[model samples]
Target: MQIATMTIDEIRVGIREQKFTAQEVVKALFQRIKKVEPEIGGYITLCEEDALQQAIIVDEKIKAGEKLGKLAGVPVAVKDNICTDGIRTTCASKMLEDFIPPYDATVVKKLKAEDAIIIGKTNMDEFAMGSSNENSAFKIVKNPWDTKRVPGGSSGGSAAVVAAGMAPLSLGSDTGGSIRQPAAFCGVVGLKPTYGLVSRFGLIAFASSLDQIGPLTRTVKDCALSLEVLQGNDPMDGTSVKEVKTKSYLDGLEEGVKGYKIGIPKGFLQKGLNEEIAKAIEDSIEKFKELGAIVEEIDLPITDAELSAYYIISSAEASSNLARFDGVRYGYRTEDFQKLDELMEKTRTEAFGGEVKRRIMLGTYALSSGYYDAYYNKAQKLREKIRQQYQEIFKTYDLIITPTTPSLPFLCGEKVNDPMEMYLGDIYTININLAKLPALSMPCGFSKEGLPIGIQLIGGEYTEDKILKAAFALEEELKLSTIIPEGKEEI
Candidate 1:
């Protein structure tokens, strides 16, 4: 059997039963990566030696009769934006191309504690700025379903790697649909936990308030298993939720969505949506009804304002958070400037990519002397209103369903030059981040060209388990969860 095709739970059981050594599992995946990575381009850095060494240690521990962590011997990849000490954590940007963290991110620490083998760091849009993987300064990640199409970003690599069977699971950071959108494009499962549900300490920040770390996996169960390991309070992150969760994400996952009240936003289905996708979402809602869910049509009028508010707020935060990289600290430095100010300007100009520069400029303008209140402050108020709207809806509905993305994966260069079109890719997803709620994307069907299409499920704050359970029920009903991209062998 190909270990790369196994789910996290299956891998855990196999390792415990001595069906295969951890070393064998890691090696098999690495071989798979070597074969498909040339076309997929899912990974930016591969930790071959370190991963194999860790596998050996895991095998030794098993032989010594020691207890293993939940994900022991499971091979996984991490988005390059999350810090991994001594490993190059380039956010697919030239600025941090040579930068290596001295300490692991909090989530990475938790992953190690669970003994999940880190096989590599996956590619992503530069600084997690753009919606298309084409924005990565290093290389663009290709959708595994069709190599010519772009994988959704900024967590594109994480999704592609999982879908390509290069890794059964991977960690991805979602600032604005980065995790879920890519999962939709690649036809996998990605969960963007309620803001602060997963600690942000050591995740290279794009937009502090909006950024969240989540998991991308082939199945909802694997996604939930990873989330259980990922969630919890971290003293390192002040924004992390302090209240301890009472239950495991995997618990009651098989429970059907009976008696649950689900809402379908009338606004999400309107304009600019693909007919095929609209039909799929409508079919999914009907399936939920068949499963005994009380489905209703709800109106969230503030949906139109989400894109503008998201851009302003996220950009403002990105400007402040990125100021730390101004040549004086770490990351890329400029040799052309003799003056300090010139050095800062030159370094940023040379190191940062076009999209990064555009965002920084927009953010700086929004936060500048006269524009702060007009732009940034106004955006903040609008964000609160948007949050309240969702809060009100959730009071009556247990979950809200929408299309994960408005359209299927586009051709690689089709929208790379058109920033507005690229920004529109996250239209259905950005507002959830603004509301600080939990949401997920799971493949609902394939397109005419066989590319994957996803349906999204949103839940109230800290209701990750509820959303996962609902997704699990619907996933079972649909029976279309296990998908391997065209070229990948089932083995």
Candidate 2:
């Protein structure tokens, strides 16, 4: 069996059939990581001894004929921003370079409950602030498909691990398009659940109302399986959904899209959309039609408003959330400081990266006394309008389909200097976050250069089931299943 290419289901069944031992799987995993990590830079930290010990315990349990949890012996990678007890969680920033949390994030705790072995904390943009991994104070994540290209940001490291066959699943937080954009670039499945579906108790905040923790995986089914373990209410997080259901996310995942209604935004294919992406989306729409689903073009008149509102609201919240990093509590503190003011100023000025500083300044200005109503308050009103428009559409359509990105994965430095151009890369994705809706991005087609293109499916709040069913249908119909980058060394 090819351990590197195995899916979550395949690995579980393989272990049950005695095809491989859990220890052997971890050993081979470390061997693969040692060989490729230099080129891939997928993880910011590695936990070889702990992961192996967890595997050994699993093997011993199997020997004793004991019942195992859902994710028994499975290896998983976590994004650095999610807290892990006794392990450093840097958020790819110098401010928290050596900071270690005393407790695990709720998502990490849930993974442990299911018997998943966390390999390590993956890299990310500093403070989850950029659309490309370039903002990372540590290193940029190279795309697995082409080394010169970028793995899309904030969650770039989380997405890169799954694409490089380093891990079968990973967790990433999405504020704007962080999770979906990277997943699209890396040719994997990424899901952003409803805002309150998962707990965020231990997540270091970027934007409180907008940030959501979700999964990145090789297949749509794997995405659903991970969600099953990750989704639940937590008393620790007041925003977590209170009314919980025990229904399996995998129950109707394969039911197919026989009579579903899917909508295509009229503005999604406008100018600036790459020709290849446009063709791929058009092809995907026809495939959905052939599968017996009704597809239509609809207008989301507040589309532009959503983009404008997202920046204002997200920045305003980020300015407030990131203020706790002052020199008093923890993290980095500058040595060149006399009094309190100098210490705070020098600490923030020295530790924060250029992108993070830019956002802080922008957010501070938006929330300033004179401009509060002009910028932040108006943006909140626009947000309500955007949410209502999406509700109006979901009343008629079961899902909204569009290209996951406007362009293919570009060369590493292509848009680093052009901030506006970088933000436009998320045009198709940010609207879903603005409306607090559930969405998924899955592989749809490949460009002539073998770079992947993805299709986004947006559903009503808490309608992940409908979105997953449509994605599973398209995933099977397209037959672009579980793509691993070419030239990956065989393990």
Candidate 1 global CA lDDT score: 0.91
TM-score of 2: 0.98
The lDDT values for all models are 0.91, 0.88
TM-score of every model? Answer: 0.98, 0.98
Off by over 4 Å in 1: none
Candidate 2: lDDT of 388? Answer: 92
RMSD of each: 1.0, 1.1
Report model 1's TM-score to 2 decimal places: 0.98
Query: Residue 300 lDDT in model 1?
Result: 80
For residue 19, model 1's alpha carbon misses the true position, in angstroms, by 0.9
Candidate 1 residue-wise lDDT, 1-491, digit = tens: 67657788889889999999999899888888898999989999999999999999999999999999999999989999999999999999899999999999999999999999999999999999988798899999999989899889999999999999999999999989999999999999999999988999999999999999999999999998999899989999999998866459888998889999999887887788998999899998999999999999899853556788999999999999889889998999998888999999999999999999999999999999999998899889999998999999999999999999999999999997888888887888999999999999999988888989999999999888889989998889887777687647753
State the lDDT of candidate 2 residue by residue for 1-491, as single tens digits: 46667788887667766689888888888888887778878799999999999998888878888988788888999999999998899999999999999999999999988888888999899999888798899988998888899999889999988888888899999998899999999999999998989899899999989999999998898989999999889999999998868458899788989899998888887888899989999999999999999998899752556777788888889889989988888999999778999998899999999988888888999999999999999999988888899999999999999888999999999999997778778888887888899999988999999999988999999999889999999999888866688888486
